[model samples]
Target: MTALFDVILPVFLVVGFGYLVCWRKWLTEVAVDGVMRFAQNFALPVLLFSAIARLDLGANYNPLLLLAFYCGAILSFLLGVALARYWLKRPIEDAIAIGFVCLFSNSLLLGVPITERAYGAEALVGNFTIISIHSPLLYTFGITAMEFARAQGQNLPLGRVALRALSGVLHTPLVIGILCGFAMNLMGLAGLVMPDGFWAAVTMMSSAALPAALFGLGGILYRYRPEGEMRAIALCCFGSLLLHPAVTFGLGKLFALSIAEMRSAVVTAAMPPGVNAYLFAALYGVAKRVSASAVLVATGLSILTVWFWLGALP
Candidate 1:
């Protein structure tokens, strides 16, 4: 327990600091955006690239582990669509966004740092696998589905939709990092260490990603309030915090993954919706408020839910 606290406390403390500063209005939107943009476009990719470059892929990597969490993702997408359309009575566009909120997790910002703390850098082999493909699988599916729905009433080209979805995956920074890392791994650059000065710079940039992301979370969260159709928002939160992880755990059991692998799968699935979902909603003008509200709600509640998982997991 004490050991767990030692790991969990620092992570949330950074998150708390970000929230506090935002609440106090010390970090303005411009500053927050700058920090977040830099982290996403540069800092996070470097962090991921470095982490992946160093990974001893032979013994640590497990391709099968992705099945557990992605099983949850698939179900969440279908559930989001069904609930939004039937239960919530929202438009197909809104339903697609709702499904997206349920599908995407805050894997990059929260998952990476927390998992590093709880499971060490080695455990990240499985963690990175999910992170690498998380956006592509979920976003591509969501985007293509939404586009297809639009096509039902019009003559949108299938080729164009496929290209757009492929573009989304290609432009993602985490995916870029994962590709670069894999390249390094294949090129036998994993063991190659940079000189002290350059290494220091890489390490500094990598370390900056977590705090910047948390601070960005704190600042961005204030933009959302519990407005609009909140029942749908509540559903999104429920799926994110509970159903997502629960489904993953069941799948892990089915796959007969190691206890540690099971723990990682569950914990990663348990993360709240990433801001990217809200960004996606806003970009396409589909359930923007619902997506933002879901991110805020799930993130606020996750402080407790994440703690419980950390303590519960062996």
Candidate 2:
């Protein structure tokens, strides 16, 4: 309990501060959006690039751990799609957007900080390992599914659809950051070829990513109210908070992951849907309400669920 509070509450408090600022109108909506733009477009990409550039692939890229975490994530995405599309009767496009909310966890904002606080900074290699491919992989999967669904209605050729989807995924800032990092890592001799000043500048930008993201997320949440979509919201919360982590936990056990690996995978899997969920929905102009509400509600629910997972993880 104390440990959980110590690890989790501070992070929420930053989010709450952002919320309070927005609610009180202390900051203009434009200002909030500007902050978010900076965070998502600039700071976060730099952060990812820096982290991945520095990551030791051989030391941290555990195949089993990746399998456990990502399998759970993909499973949650599939289940979310089924629930939203079939049970909830959302349109296929809307279902894919909602499923993306389940697919993309708050890995950087919530997962990294919470894991660092709970376990220690040394345990973050696994978290970074997962994060390295997370956005690129999931966004590719989501975009391909979404584009093919749209193509069915538009009578577009499969080649064009595939090309369009690939174009969309490659154009995203996060994916660009990951690709650049991989390029640097592979070609630059694991980032050793970079000058100290270059890394220093990257570090400077990286420092602003999380706080700006959280604050901007709070401001965005202020705009999205939970009007209808109650069932969908509940489904999203269930998929993100409970289902994802449970799958990861089971897989970690089956894989015989170490305590640190289990902790990183399960804790990260337990995070709420990130602000990117809303962004993704907004990008497609589908299920924006459900995705935003899921990000807000699941984040609130995670305060307890995360504690439960913390206790439950061995």
Clashing pairs in 1: none
Task: Report per-prediction Cα RMSD to one decimal.
Answer: 2.4, 1.6
Tens digits of per-residue lDDT, candidate 2, 113-179, equal 8998898989888898999988878888888999998888688888898888788888888888988
Regions more than 4 Å wrong, model 2: 190-192
lDDT for each candidate structure = 0.81, 0.89
Candidate 1 lDDT over 1-314, as tens digits, reads 65347765677677777777778889887887888888888888888887776667776567667878988987887898899999999999999889889999998788877888877877666777677667667777877887788778677788987887788777888778877877876666536655679668889999888788877777777777877788999889888888889898887878888877876788899899999989878877989989998998898788778888777666
lDDT, residue 8, candidate 1? 59
Residue 131, candidate 1: C-alpha displacement in angstroms: 1.3
Among all windows of ten consecutive residues in candidate 1, which has the lowest summed lDDT?
Answer: 185-194
**Candidate 1 lDDT score relative to the true structure:** 0.81
